[model samples]
Target: MPPRYSYWTIILNGTATSFRSATRDELIPTLYQLKKLDPKAVLKWFARGRLWESPSEARAAAQQRRSRTRTGAKETSRDRNWRPGGTHRDPKARTAERKKVTRGHRTNSERGRPKGGKVH
Candidate 1:
């Protein structure tokens, strides 16, 4: 007889359909469910690379999303400038803002650390 489906398995299927992609957390629960259903099936899927997104593709997608979320030019001048109670009071504050915005999301280790630990 076929194994019974668990709640997590059902949730994962639903979420995957809605997102059109599965995050690690989303996949994990499904993996557990699959394991419970059939360990061999889980292993086979992994072997076929049906589990996770390619690292490069995932990174690019995240960057694209971040860029899309930034405030558009339609924002008021006050919104573009620092709020009275906010940080960044300096006239050159935009430089810092640009750096903060463009800075890679990953740390050195993630980007491949330098041999000497000094940033070029």
Candidate 2:
């Protein structure tokens, strides 16, 4: 059978459709089916760069493409807690505070080893 919609039409529709309502995942399977039906259709879409429109769509497509391309079933960590600039506090600050608290117990010689001796 002939294709239901052209590749460009689908890509444009994906971008024009509302982000919340758009069914972006549908594109890959549709493309796959189209590829099976007509290899030329898939090549045509690639030649025109009509696969994905936005960066988000491109990223999603890349991930999907990778998953399909790969053979092994790998486990991926979904932990989102690890991120830069989101540290609870400066660990050095805590360590410095502890050092400062115990610092008074030490003699001047033990603290910095002054060349001229302790500064009484």
Candidate 3:
């Protein structure tokens, strides 16, 4: 028999899997069927002469592109949260607020030293 859809492809575990659907809405059901066959197998979608990470990702991208074209607006740039000169906080204040931990401290030179003198 001839294929129902004009273009559709599904891959699971590096092998092509058979599925029949006449509309894009079949993507979700196809994904679920693949999951049942092999939950841990790698899933992929081949459509529009391009490879996609998953069927859902391709659908989402298509929806997003449609919305953007409908609005006919360019994406706006965002301003940086920082200034060019330097950080807002003062270095001196940060050092003053820092605490020194001296409990159970032993320097490398002080370690393994005898009470008499240095060991030759």
- Each candidate structure's TM-score, on Cα atoms with residue i matched to residue i, is 0.21, 0.24, 0.29
lDDT of 1 by residue, 17-107 (tens): 2222223456565566665765543311111223333545545665776676674543345645565655847657778778867974566
The TM-score obtained by model 2 is 0.24
Identify the runs in model 3 with alpha carbons over 4 angstroms from their true place.
4-42, 73-120
Instruction: List, residue by residue over 23-110, the lDDT tens digit for candidate 3.
Output: 4466667777778978854445565555576667777888997899779766754355433457744556655545323355555466
**Residue 79 error for model 2, in Å?**
24
Deviation (Å) of 112 in candidate 1: 81
lDDT of 2 at 34: 57
**Top-lDDT candidate index:** 3
**Number of colliding residue pairs in model 1:** 0
The candidate with the higher lDDT, 2 or 3, is 3
